[model samples]
Target chain A: MRATLMYGAGDVRVETVPDPVLRAPTDAIVRTMRACVCGSDLHPYRSMHPSATGRPVGHELVAVVEEVGPEVRTVRVGDLVVVPFAYADNTCAFCREGLQTSCPHGGFYGNHEVGGLQAELARIPFADGSLAVVPDVDPASASDALLHSLLALSDVYLTGYHAAHVGAVGPRTTVAVVGDGAVGLSAVLASRRMGAERIILMGRHTDRTDLGRRWGATDVVAERGGEGVERVLELTGGEGAHVVLEAVGHMPAYEQSFGIVRPGGVISRVGVPQYESAPVGFGSLFGKNARLAGGPAPVRAYQDGAIADVLAGAIDPGLVFDTVLSLDDAAEAYRLMDSRASLKVSLRP
Target chain B: MRATLMYGAGDVRVETVPDPVLRAPTDAIVRTMRACVCGSDLHPYRSMHPSATGRPVGHELVAVVEEVGPEVRTVRVGDLVVVPFAYADNTCAFCREGLQTSCPHGGFYGNHEVGGLQAELARIPFADGSLAVVPDVDPASASDALLHSLLALSDVYLTGYHAAHVGAVGPRTTVAVVGDGAVGLSAVLASRRMGAERIILMGRHTDRTDLGRRWGATDVVAERGGEGVERVLELTGGEGAHVVLEAVGHMPAYEQSFGIVRPGGVISRVGVPQYESAPVGFGSLFGKNARLAGGPAPVRAYQDGAIADVLAGAIDPGLVFDTVLSLDDAAEAYRLMDSRASLKVSLRP
Candidate 1:
C-alpha cells in the first residue's frame, strides 16, 4: 500500500507500506478514497529536522471501511466514512462533553501507532466514535467535489465551525476571520451559516480573499497588523468585530485578534500557536472584558453537522482544494501547498 | 473637605482638600456616606513611587448625592446610591453592550480631577450611569450591615458575579474559586446563587476561607501550586472544575486556573494581572480545549441586580468588612489591609 511520509523540511514522498490490520476489537480497516495536505502540515514542512527514517504524514481522509473488528458496531464493511483527525472512545467523560481531542484514550492520526490517513489502507481505533458515515452518499459513485468536502469534515471545516460556534457568532455579530488558508475560508463559510450579518476577511492574498468574499465575507481587508485592525474596525463601523475567528496562530495574528475585537467580544483561534506566551493582561483581553476561546478543535463533535451542511449543498467547502494529484506526487503536493501555489492539494490513493 | 491621600508605598494620609464642584453636565457631587479600601488599592500602596504631592486613594463608595449637573437625569440630590468604581455615560454603544468600563468617556475615580471616594465630598462624572440608587434604603438610619453590602456592589461583589456570569456557572457546573480575597469569596456567593451545587474555595487563609465556607463553599482546598491543582481535581472526581474563578492576578494564579480546569471549561480572572504574558499554547489552555475569560469586572452592568440581591437579604457581601474606622484613620486602614490584619476596612468620613 502506498502512503505519504516526510523525511525533513520540504521532503514529502509516497512509498509502499504494509497494509493496516485491525489490532483491537473496536478497530476497523479503512481503504482511503480521498486525502489532503493540511495547513498544519506546512508547519513541519518548513522546520522539521532531517532524518534517515521518515515520519508518516496527513490526517484528513474520506474512505470506505474494508474490515472491522467484532466490537465495532457503528461502522461496518463497505460503508463510506469521514474520520476525525483524532480518534476517541465516544463514551468517555471528556468526549461526552464534546472535547474528544482531550479524551484520555484518544490519539491523533499520523502517529506510529495509528499510521497516516494519506494511504491506500489504514487502521482506525474506536471505530464507533472515530468514524462518521457520509449520509446518502455512495463511495464509488460520489463526485470528487463531494469526496473533497467530506475529507474537509475530517479537520478543516469542523475546525472553522468550532471557532465560530464557540465565539458565539450570530446575526447580531460582526465577524472578522484572520487568515486566508482553507480553515480561515471555512470560518467565513461557517460564520455566514451562523448568521453573522457582517463578515470581514483579513489576509494579504488577493486570490484567497476573493474566495473568502464569495463565501459570505461582506468585506476583505488585505492588510496585516495595525492596518489590518484598522480596516476591520472601519468595515464594522469603527466598533470592531463581535467575533474574531483567528485561523493564523502566530503572535501577530493573535495580537490582531485583540485589536479588532469589540469590547466584550470573543477571539477564537483554531491555528496551532507557534509561541507559548502572549499578553493577556490589562492592555489586551482583560481591559476590554473580552474572551479567548478555541484550541485543537474537537472536530469529532462537529462531524455530523458539517456532513449535513456539505451534503445539503449549503456550502462548497471542497472548493478549498484547488489542486489534485495521485498519491505518488506527494512531494509536489507538499511544495505546492508550502509555497502557496495551492490552497490545498487533494491526493487520490 | 477631608480626603485620603497616598504619598508613596505604604504611606497614607488624611488631609483637607477643596470641595468637589460640578465639572461637566453629567457630573454630580457625592457626599461620602460610606467608603472602603479595596484589594486593588493594595497594588498602588505596594508599588507607588514616593512623591511630594500625594494622590487621591479610594474608589468604592455608598453616598448621598449632594448635587447634580443639569444633564444628570437618573440621579438627583438626596438619593442614596452605590457608585461603580468607574463612571460612564451608559448611553454609548459600549455601555449599551454592558461594557461601561470600556466606554470612551468613562474614567476611574482617584484622579486629581475627581478626587476620591475616601473624601468629605467627591465629584462623579456620568452620574446617571455611575450611581445606582440603593432602592428604598435610608442613608441616615440604614444598618451598617446594609451599607457594607451596598459598598460591595460598587466593585467586589459585582466583580465576583461578573466572573461567575461570564464563565457560565450554572446548576450543571462545579465551580472553583482561586483566592480568599473579598472578590473570591463573592464568587463563592455568586456561584451558589447561580445554582452550582458544589463550590470549592482555594486559599491558604483560614479566616477568609471560613467566610467562604459560610457563603456556600462545599469544599475548601487550602493548598497552593501543584497541590492545589491536585486537590481541586480530587474534589471534582478527577475531572476538574467546570468553571475556575481566578481572583488572584499573579502568574501562579493563572497557572492554577489552567491546571484545574476541565476540558472545555472556562477560567475567568477578575484579579488585576501583575504580569502581561502567560502560556496559551498547546501545553496549557489550547491542549485542554479550555477557555480564558474575565478581566476588570463590569460592575456597572451588574449594579442593579446586585442592589436588588443585597436589599432583598439574598446576600451579605458586606461581611468581608471585618474592621471599621473614621476617615482620620485612613493611614491605619491602609496598613491593616496591607498587612492582612483586616479582611477589608470600612471608612466613615
Candidate 2:
C-alpha cells in the first residue's frame, strides 16, 4: 500500500508501504477513503520539530473498516468510520473522564507502532473506542462534501469543538478565534454551533476571513500582535471576548490569546504548542482570572457528536478544504499547507 | 499614626507615619483592628522580591471604618470590615465579572499610592467595593478567635476559597492542597466547605499538617518532588486528584502542580507567582487538558461569604495564627513567620 512519508525538511513523498494487519483482538484494519494534511504536520515539516526518518505522515482520515479482530464487537467490516488521531482503550479513568488524549493506553498516529492516516491501509488499536461509525453510510456512495466533513471529525473539527467546549463558548458568549487556518475556521464553525452570539476571526488573509464571515464570524481583525488585540477589543466594545480560541500553536498566538481575552474569560487552545514555555505570570492570565484549557483534544470522545452534526448538515466544516488531490500529489499538499497557500488540503487514497 | 515599614531586607521597623486622609469621594479611612504577616510577606522579607524603602509591610487586615467620603455608601464609620488587599471600583466590567483584582481602577497594597494594611490606618480607595462589612459585630466585643478568623477572610481564607472556586472543587471531588502553609491549610478548609469528599494536604511540617487535619485534610503527603507526586498518585489510586490547589509561589510548586493533577483536572494557584515563565507545553499541561487557573484572589468578590462563614463558625481558618504580638514587635512577627516558627502572626495596632 502506498503512504505519504517524510524523510527530512522539504522532503515528502508517496512511497509503497507494507499493509497493516490486526495485531490485537481489539484492532481493526482501515482502508483509507480520505486523508488530509494537518496544520500540526507543518511543525515537523518546517523542522521546528524533529522528524522521524521515513515515517508515514497524516493523522486525520475518514476510512472504511476492511477487517476487525474477534474482540472488536462494536465496529464491523466495511463500515465507513472517522478515525480519531489518538487510539484509546476508552475504559481507563481518564477516558471515562472524557480525556481520551491522555488515556494511559492510548497511542497517537505516526508513532512507532501505528500506521499513519495518509495510507491505503492503517491498523487501528482499540477500534471500538477510537473509530466512530458514520452510520448507514457507504463510502462509495456518500457525497464528496459529506466525506470531507466526516474526515474533519477525525481530527480538525473535533479539535475545534474541543477548543470551543473547553473555552466554555455558549449562548451570550463572545468568541475570538486566533489563526485563519483550517483549525481556526473550524473553531468559528464550532463556536457558532455552540451558540456564541458574537464571533471574531483574527487573521490577515482576505479569502480566509471571507470564509470566516460565511461561517458565522461577526467580525474579522487583520492586525497582528498588539494591534490585533486592539482591534478585537474595539470590536468587542473594548471589553475583549469572553472565549478566545487559540488555533495557532506558537508563542505569539498564545500571547494574543492572553491579550484579547476579557477578564474572567477563558482561552482554549487545541493548537499543537510550538513553545516549550509561556510566561503566564501575575500580569498575564492569572490576575485576570482567565483560564487556559484544551490540549491535543479528546478527539475520540468528541468524534461521535461532531460526526452526527456533520451528517445532519448542522455544520459544514469541510469547506476548510480549499485544495484537493490524489494520494500521489502528497508533496504538493504539504507545500500548499506549509506556505499558507491553502487553508487545508484533502487527499483521496 | 504608627505603621510597619520594610526598610530593606531583614529590616522591619514600627515607625510613626502620617494619618490617612480621604482623597476622593470613593475613599474610606480604615483603622486597623488586626493585621498579620502573610506567607507571601517572606518573599520580600527574604529579598526574594524587591522591597521599596519605607513601604508598609502587610496586606491582610480586619479593620474598622474610621471615616468615609460622600460616595462611600455601603460602609459606615465604626463598622468592622474585611479590607481586600486590592482596591477595586466594583463598577468596572471586570469587577462586575467578579474579577475585582483585574478591575481597571484596582490597585494592590504597597504598589503605589495605596497605604498598606499593616498600619494604624489605611486609606482605602473604592471603599464600597474593597471593604466587606463584618455584620452585627463590633471589633471590641468580638472574641479573639472570631477576630483572627475574620482577619483570614481579609486574605488567606478568601484566597483559599478562590483557589477552590477556580479549581472547580465540588461535591465528591478529590482535592489536593499543595504547600501546607496557612493558605494551603485554608484551602483544605475551603475544599471541605466546597463539598470535596477527599482532601490531601502535601507538606512536611507536622504542625502545619496537624492544622491541615483539623481543617479536614483526609491525607497528608510529606514527600517532595518526584516522591511527593508518587505519594499523591498512590493516595489517589494512581489517578491523581481532581483539583490541586497550589499555594506555594515558585517553579517547583508549579511543576508539582502539573505533576499531580489528573488529566482534565485544574490547578488553581492563589500563590503570587515568582517565576517569569512556566513550561506549559504540549507534553505537560496542554496535552493533558489540565487547566491552570487562579491568581491574586479576588477577595473583594469573595470576602462577604467567607467572613460570614467564619463568623458563623462554619470554618476556623484563624487557627493558622499561631503567634500574636503588638505592632511595635513587627520585626519579630516577620521573624517568626520568616523562620517558619509561626504559620501566621497577628499584630494588634
Top candidate on TM-score is 1
Give the per-residue lDDT of model 1 (tens digit) for B135-188: 776678998999999999889998999999999999989999999999999999
Query: B136-192, model 2: which lDDT tens digit per residue?
Result: 996789888999988898889888889999988999799998898999998999898
- Chain B alone, model 2: TM-score? 0.97
Residue A320 in candidate 1, Cα distance off native in Å: 0.2
Give each model's whole-structure lDDT: 0.90, 0.88
What are the per-residue Cα lDDT tens digits for candidate 1 across A7-107?
A: 99988889998888889999999998988899998899998999787899889989999999999887879999999998899899889889899889999
| Model 2 chain A: lowest-lDDT 10 consecutive positions | A48-57
CAPRI-style grade of the A/B interface in model 1: high
Q: Please state the error at residue A79 of candidate 2 in Å.
A: 0.9
| CA displacement after TM-score superposition, residue B58 of candidate 2 (Å) | 1.7
lDDT of 1 at A68: 95
Q: Which residue ranges in model 1 land beyond 4 Å of their true spot?
A: none
